[model samples]
Target chain A: MDNYPYAEQTDNELVRLSLSDPNQFLYLSKRYEDKLLRYITRISKFSRDEAEDVLQEVFIKTYYNLNGFDPDLKFSSWIYRIAHNETISAIRKKVARPTVSLDSEDLKNFTDSFDLSRDLDKSFDRKLINQALSKLDDKYHEVLVLRFLDEKDYVEIADILKKPVSTVGNLILRGKKLFKEEYNKLIINKNTK
Target chain B: MKNKNISQIVLERIKGEKIKPISRRIFYIKKVLFWTVVTLSLIIGSFIFSLILSGLFNNDWDLYDRFGFNFIMKTLPYFWLGSFLIFTILGEYYYRKTLLGHRLRYVIVIGFYMISTIIFGSIFYFVGIGDVLEKSFIDISPVYRNIILNRINFWSQPEEGLLSGIVTKIGNEEIEVKDSNGLIWSVNINGASNRNQVNLFVDEKIKITGDIIDDSLFVADEFRSW
Candidate 1:
């Protein structure tokens, strides 16, 4: 994956480049941006316009403060902090705005499996994943996002959320429980149909 | 509603847009300034510690004798440069209410530094060009190697009839030799020193020719009892 562009260099080497060569910090950006956007999008429940805008702000912050980054913490943890704050901000903005959609289709788009296969020539549809993600709470949703989508380890999740490893673990367990409960609700409805 | 399908769809939508680039110039300037301040503060702290130690302990201690100090000095400039670079590129992740995000910057910097050093060090070591590497954790200095290799030059001794007329002082694998003209030379007594080396004791005048290593010690290859 493009996630680790400088695979030969250790995270430390990349960090040096980030601090000394700001442009090099793009390694971090390229690696994290997609996953971060997904995470924010999931957390913020923003439509395309809102999520994209929030993502831009997050990146701007990441790039600007790139030098201040210490390599001691996992890169993902730092990025998550930005994403988390950005998502919160976006959510606040949505709360303030008058535009609201009651229907799930109007609130966000779903992947049209048939259309995606025909047009994008891709096998997977992201909209379905987002729905399932939305069904989970901040705790479970975020942990799942970090673990599967973002591919960050538990330690990194703990660090990103500023919780202890055990706390992060507990969140993951409870989150999974909640997600299972919610996932069953959606699936049961789909089966009835 | 399958979990796998949901994950795939979520990933795609997240990948939906290109993240906007931040203003590079403004961001980097601030980055450099911030890191410069951090490095300088660290150096200032270390310098103070060093000063305190100098005043308190052995004032006559040579500065370069410490390995940790050397490490700090070597990497200090890189820290400043790296900070400057980061300041110019990303600007601010966010200022207020985003202290966690701000702290994350340090994490990234440190992570990169560690990973890079190991990669570079390993590459340099395996490629057989480590000898030319500018910075290293491995002791690449030749003096240490040479001392361990050609280590026979530490004492003076008498062995054969050849050591005649040379007085020998012996102690701990070392011997001091004085010839008829009273010229003293210290040489090492080593069995593995070299082929045909000599050994001797006190009051035994030995005639021998010795080689000096940097005028510090001597190695005797030939000796005769006087």
Candidate 2:
């Protein structure tokens, strides 16, 4: 085995091994956890917390249905599929919950970190960008965020979303348009010197 | 647990306090169970198929001339599978609609039962349960195997039944029976704990109906009566 067990296996073999020896799937998690985590983190409008919860559900579900997958299919695509479903489900559950009460301190602190030039250190355009991202439809938000943040290819996003790769490409085009418009508006208003 | 806005949330929560990552025991058990299931289902499924042959075609079971003979025979694997699946689905549906519905993990947990059934079932079948069919099975003309499998795919199981039959042989986990017309039946009474003991003799008239699926035989949802 290579130092990186996941690095050596193809998605098909990983899934096959996952079926008989599920712990092998732990390799899958090691490989994709950060990537998928970032996916939900980005999709949930940089809400790493909600995204983390969503990621857990995705892994658990994947553990069980890993066999349900057809071997010919790509492993990353299948993992993304679960991520997409779990994210949508988590979002639904959240919408049903009473509004997310922002502790004034957290919001003020989060907002205070939003300065364009100074705060771009990490939470660049932090509060405002995240908030505007939250406003887009989940599908729109998810595609763009996964594309930019997760750096997944079009086929990967299509696999996650269970659409044709061409469909995903179109989604990115549309999502990017909306995202750029909203983003430009945010930067224009805040960064006008 | 932080209720702060989504940004504070990340990929950490997808993990639980305990990382029980499918222990070695479970992994081994899963392999054992899987083979055991495939083996047992093959055996059970073959027996069920013999009965089906008796029911569908009287004596000679000669399927050489049939257009779908190969298709029906190739389906030999799925009957075992369909039987297992149909039973699990029905059992859960029955339990929920009848009495034991409060199980939050009911659906996912039922899947575990399936893995166990497949491993053990395959084991039994592989261990020489139907040696007689070896000639008729392997020697099966490839043309017929595909046809038989195709035929089997079209049939499903009933949810309940008034199947009257006499018990022929009882095993550690299954019940064998002879229907009124002199056909064999393998009634898996493994999960029927709440029901009355179904003992079949040479002429014990009986009818039974429940969602019983055998991953090795066929879908039980189509098993309304037998």
Candidate 3:
């Protein structure tokens, strides 16, 4: 395993190799850990420890079910789906803890595009955006995060959520509509105060 | 450092756990077999449902004018329709489990089923599988036949000019029948034009179409085994 160039291997190649050489699975785990951990935290609002526990379970489950993974799908989308399922199950066990911790760099990019976009109010800032997101239902919130923050396309989002691409598009559309409405309501309340 | 540590933890968990993957070929074969069974059952169920509908409409609906809506509804096969609905619901479940079915929109899924049922129903009717399936069920299980087919025995009516039942007593002039509704009807087969064809026997089910002489007696103008 040490002599082989695991870093240069594609995800599919890594998966195929990992089946025979179990130690080669480490490279796959290292590849997805950061991205999946961040995703778990963002989606479920889990603490670092809770997210890590869920992430560990996700990877372990992924390893066991590696044969079941459809090779036609993107590896990232498939792994994210397992993470999404684990996070949802964890949330069911423990009440969702909505933490407002956006990646500053990602937030900057979002704000820049949000300012140019017509769906959201231009006057909104990160704090107001977070408040609106918290107000939205879990379904809308998950779609919005996967779309803008994770930057997954419609098909990728559909694979992760196990829904139709059209449904993902509709959810994003509805999410934007609801986010704007919620943000405006918050602005009104703040002004009255 | 923390990220690598969690990755190691995950790796350790995988190592400790039993991670035997089922052979992909076997997994897919099982899925295909399960889907095939579901599809075949759905086709048969839809065919049977179409037969019931075809049988109902094949009759002279002019009887509806005399019998009214309640009689028509009561005579319609509810059991067959219920089976059709059950199979349709199961078909939706298996359909959504497929790769293409998962990717389809809800509206498209529903539209697909509606179109499929229409196509299958028509093919079953035109191919005559509909009547064959219905008859086969009746022949295979008399208990099932008595319970399901007997409910919509539209042949059992003397007041509206059709009566059918098992022959309880075959007399020299009159044949006694235990009607579907359990009434003993005396059918006057003597001197009828089809009296020669009215070969009567005890315990054999038969249909008689004629004028009702009274509550318990019918003047048989036509007679045949039910």
Candidate 4:
């Protein structure tokens, strides 16, 4: 047991070993900490502390349900799914805080795909983008965050949201339309004021 | 609660609770059992629906003696129809809980149950299984017979229109008949133009379609023994 390098192991291997030696579970948790923290903040607009609280619960639930995890699913997707649900539950308990912080890198990556033809890299700042994002319904907002900021594909978003892939695609398209409409309206209001 | 490290907190929580993942075999076994129940419910539900349809289609709609179209509508076997709807909803619920079912859109899931019901219903009706189930349900359950199924008893009620039973006495113009409900009626065949076809013999089970003139008197229009 001393000779085995648990740190170098794959997630699946770590899961198997964690059953025998529970301490081996640490590696799996360590792998997703930063990503999950960012995910919670992005989805729920939670403060750093609130996101940490939700992250802790997510990890705890994951450990408890480890045996129930289907081996056929990717470990990353499963963990993200748990994180997604926990964040939603936490938000449901409290009135949602405004969630508007667009990562410039993410915006750059998805600008072309979203058909925001303007050179968003030069013109759009975080505050305006976040304001427009906040105007969307919760469902539309959630999908936009997952698709653009999280950079998840339709299948992964489907897995996390527990919806059909086709539904995820439809949500993104609708979200994009709403996002553009809201953003344009904001710009018009600002000019008149 | 002071822990800044996520992994350490999770490990501590698991150690405190002594939590372990459930065995994979148990999960698979439960899934299989759930699927089996869904399939059986689908089959039984479809068969019941077919029975209701069969009863409706096999009836003599033209027998409008006393109980006209309104009588037929009132006795349209809604008990089986209600049961079919209930089971279809349950089947859809169970299907949605499955792994593959979770991936399907709502329309597709609903469409699956609708298609399954039609296909299985046709098979059940074609093989006479639906009729057998309908007859057995009425024969076996008194609760069903007296409550829900009894509404269809209009088809057997002499007062409502049609009655079937044994011919206890045969006269030249009228016959004394004992209906399935064990009520006796003096059926008048003299007025029927098809009186020659209204042949009655003693101790024979027969169906007499006509109008009830009084509590004990029924005017017969048609009679058949099968």
TM-score, prediction 4: 0.84
lDDT of 4 by residue, B106-204 (tens): 788778887888788978888998778776876798677657764436647766567676799988998888865678989887766552354567987
Model number with the top DockQ: 3
Worst lDDT window (10 residues) for model 3 chain B?
B191-200
Query: How would you encode candidate 1's per-residue C-alpha lDDT over A13-83 as one tens digit per residue?
Result: 76567565554555655555556656665555577666666766676666556655656676667778778
- Please say which candidate is ahead in TM-score: 2 or 4: 4
lDDT of 2 by residue, B1-226 (tens): 2333221122233233323334456545655555555445444544544433332332112323432565345434454346546655654443333211222246453555455544544454455443334325424654433333333222222232324345567566566655444656666655554233534344443344344455222111112111
Q: CA lDDT of each candidate?
A: 0.49, 0.51, 0.75, 0.75
Candidate 4 deviates by what RMSD? 4.2
TM-score of the second chain in candidate 2? 0.26
What are the candidates' C-alpha RMSDs? 18.8, 18.8, 3.9, 4.2
Clashing pairs in 3: B157-B162
**DockQ, prediction 2:** 0.06
Model 2 chain B scores worst on lDDT over the 10 consecutive residues at B217-226
| lDDT per residue (tens digit) for residues A1-193 in model 2 | 2356667787778766766655576666666776666556544433666666677677777765655555445677778878877876776777632112223443444335333234333334545566556656666766766565555787667656655466577777786566546656777677786
Which clashing pairs does model 4 show? Answer: none
Off by more than 4 A, model 2: A1-6, A45-50, A96-128, A191-193, B1-226
**Whole-model lDDT, candidate 2?**
0.51
The CA lDDT at A131 in model 1 is: 56
What candidate 1 gets wrong by more than 4 Å, as runs, is A1-7, A96-133, A190-193, B1-226
